[model samples]
Target: MAIKDTSETVDNKLEDKELDKTDLASVTNGAILGRDLTPEEDRRILRKANLHLLPIMAFAYLFQFLDKTALSYTAILGLREDLHLKGEEYGWASAIYYFGYLVATYPIAGVLLVRFPIAKVIAITMFIWGAILMFTALCRNAKDLLTTRFFLGMAETAIAPGLSMIVAMWYKRSEQPLRQGAWFLGNTSAGILGGLVSYGFGHLHLLWGFDDSCFHHGSNLSPRHVRDDRFLTKDGRAQAVARVETNMTGIKNDKWKREQVMEALCDPNAWLLAVAYLASIIPNNGLLTGLGFSVLKTLLINILPSVFQLVFVLISVIGSTYLPNTRLLFMALNVVVSIVGAVMVREVDPVHKWTRVMGCALGVAFTANFPMTMAMVSSNFAGFTKKTTVSAMVFIAYCAGNIIGPHLFFPSEAPGYKSGFLAVMICLAISAVLCIVLRFYLILENKKRDDAGDAIEVPLEGINLSDKTDREIPQFRYIY
Candidate 1:
């Protein structure tokens, strides 16, 4: 397919006729734009757009997560020993990144989204974080690791919100779940990817110059081979490692300034969605940061370790993406899984570990919420400004959750983080309630509009929700 610039396409359409600014308002809802195409054509447009958009957002998130989580894997490989990190220092370093993320997330959503081209903004941020990830290999201690993580968080703050804004601009309400699911699958994919990468790195530690004390291939090998081994210089090997790392730094582009991005923050719906996102995010981040440690320290010793973690990651990705009635069902299932996981953590049996893993996997179901909410906001809001504002708000909530999640990991609850599990359970339960409330609210609003004779016919034309000047089609009610 031809890669046509969307902005240029819009410009060409405008030049074809003396553009009617007023007419733009008339079709803000499904009214006029819906009328312009047949149902099949409309489906085709939305489907194609989603197919293109979701993968981009998902992959962007996948790499963003890989960079963020790399620290955890590194820590397992003597990052702490190498850097002289102390107890709770790892927790603090991990938590600090979210602080940077939280500070930047709302600002980008509220300001930069309006003034900048999202694609350019996101691409630039991605490149910056990738560079930071590569630099992390050079860190000598906790302080350096913390600083790099903070900057990494800052660079990634644009991703969830920016992608939400972009998705909103393209798809309607009914089509949101699957598209959103696709984007959220990035998180699940990250879990699987992180594990695999860590496993590879752990294995690499046994090679010629890579051996760290935690992993020694020589000790496991035949005595003759162990004695014969004469390793290369650490400094020489480190230089080669540095060179390889530097080459992995990704691309960079121009960034949008603060003022230009804030326009998306002003919408009220943005705030509502942010609140909803916060409801889910608290548990999600908490689980992600600690789950690996829990599996390694507790479960890996007793079970077929690969099967346990692999199952959790697989269930998370598949259940979230392909589950029926994704929005409500997934949230409901997450609540059950979290509660069970929390309960199982306190048990003594090996089967209990499986329960905890299942609970963790269920947490993955929350991924559906991100995409669904984005689609809802996009379809309901009119005009570029309003849409962008709400998009920013959604991300602000995402950042809030990330910040709140890690704090639940208290030192008092180490080994088996009982308190954090309970806290996450509460978060997931709250998400379920919110989903129900939003669903009913949309239903009532639709009914009221239908009664008022302002109901929009499907296959509408020219109407968009963001266009405020357009006549209110009384039937146009907000879909829950």
Candidate 2:
């Protein structure tokens, strides 16, 4: 055989190591299954990881959204009448939850991840919020409602940031957009589920044998009620009503302590992400929070209410799931949709105008920005501690936008929320510019690393980072 240089042998070994690192595992017998792996193999792995991870995160967010937006659905029933709420009382009730969320978000991100397991913390928080949501039915007055909403906010503050941290731990930068899109599709799904649940709950008072008073209409009375009725000299209906009220005040115990969520607040990256989140989320909240409901209400007059809601849900689902390049695409789409929708508001007697407006709003406002923001924060930060901190900061900004959203629902802009829509359009434009800038910044950072000869090294399985000398491995650069 011809003699090969030692240098050539060393280069061949390095190439072999890289190739081994890039192969996928086989299902049976724990073997390396694939052959001749390429860049496309790396992409496939990323896509599979995203597919597995995004659905889990999306389902988690679906429950979070249900817990958060349950109030909006509840408001459609007799809650306002029963609670005797006044002007802006509903808005305040909705906004106050975000205030509680804001107070807790950073703390959860910075401190909690360091102290507790992520899954445990997230599950506990989810259970707490779910309990809070179930308790909302028991709220007797505006004060009680506000208190409940505030606590609900507090319980939910951990989920968004915590999930972002999880994503960062598992994924690379280029893999974020599609994963983020999948997660945000949950929001769209939540809308559909919320509307259906709301419509069903709204009709609960009409269930079989139930009177308009939401009581079973049997003349027969129980022994306890009958006994109480004799003393009051009337039927036992009032006593039965009292018993129902007592039974409905479900469990009200606090599941998580303040100290448990303190880690999320301590990071610098959290603050940076918060700035980005604030820029992106303000307009999103403005359009989706109150404007969506208002548009639905107005369009019910000319359009079939079912058609309008169906269209809204469909648009939201498709826009959220399908959008590529989540950060830039969502922001750009939002601005264009808002401007077009606003202009369309002036169209007299256009068929399905409400549907058009809703489709645009769902595409622009409700879909992509949320997921992208979370993904961006996750991609930028690393380790559980720093990731949690950044995630919390992003959500804190999200809370600010939530607070600001309802304020845009001015009484003066009733029927047609022109000013609010226009304002959101401007905000969307600003966010689009910021996203582009951030993209460029990331690109520059990656380029600098490449220039320094620090490109990512693909390590073989069981290779330890500590064992690999700097000269032996290429640097892993972040994707912009």
Candidate 2 accuracy as lDDT: 0.49
In model 2, the Cα lDDT at residue 451 comes to: 81
RMSD per prediction, one decimal?
A: 14.4, 16.9
In model 1, the runs with Cα more than 4 Å from the true position are 1-35, 38-54, 202-272, 287-333, 346-352, 455-461, 469-475
| True lDDT of residue 376, candidate 1 | 58
Candidate 2: deviation at residue 223, Å?
Answer: 51
Q: How many pairs of residues collide in each model?
A: 39, 17
lDDT of 1 by residue, 1-480 (tens): 222233443444355332233222222211221122436544545554555456667777666666676666666655678889898798778778887887786566555654555665676666666666666767777888789888878887877766665554444444444555566667656656666656545522122112112112222221111012123133222221222111111011123333323444543444555676688777655433333345344323222322333344345435544553344444445545555554555343434455555555544545545556665555565444445556656666776687778788786776567677677777767866776666565566666666766345421222332233111334344544
What lDDT would each prediction earn against the true structure? Answer: 0.51, 0.49
| Alpha-carbon runs more than 4 Å astray in model 2 | 1-56, 203-273, 285-335, 342-356, 359-366, 454-476
Tens digit per residue, CA lDDT, model 2, 300-403: 32123223333433443345345533444444455455445545543323354555455444334433456656665555543333345456666777888778
Supply the TM-score for candidate 2. Answer: 0.64
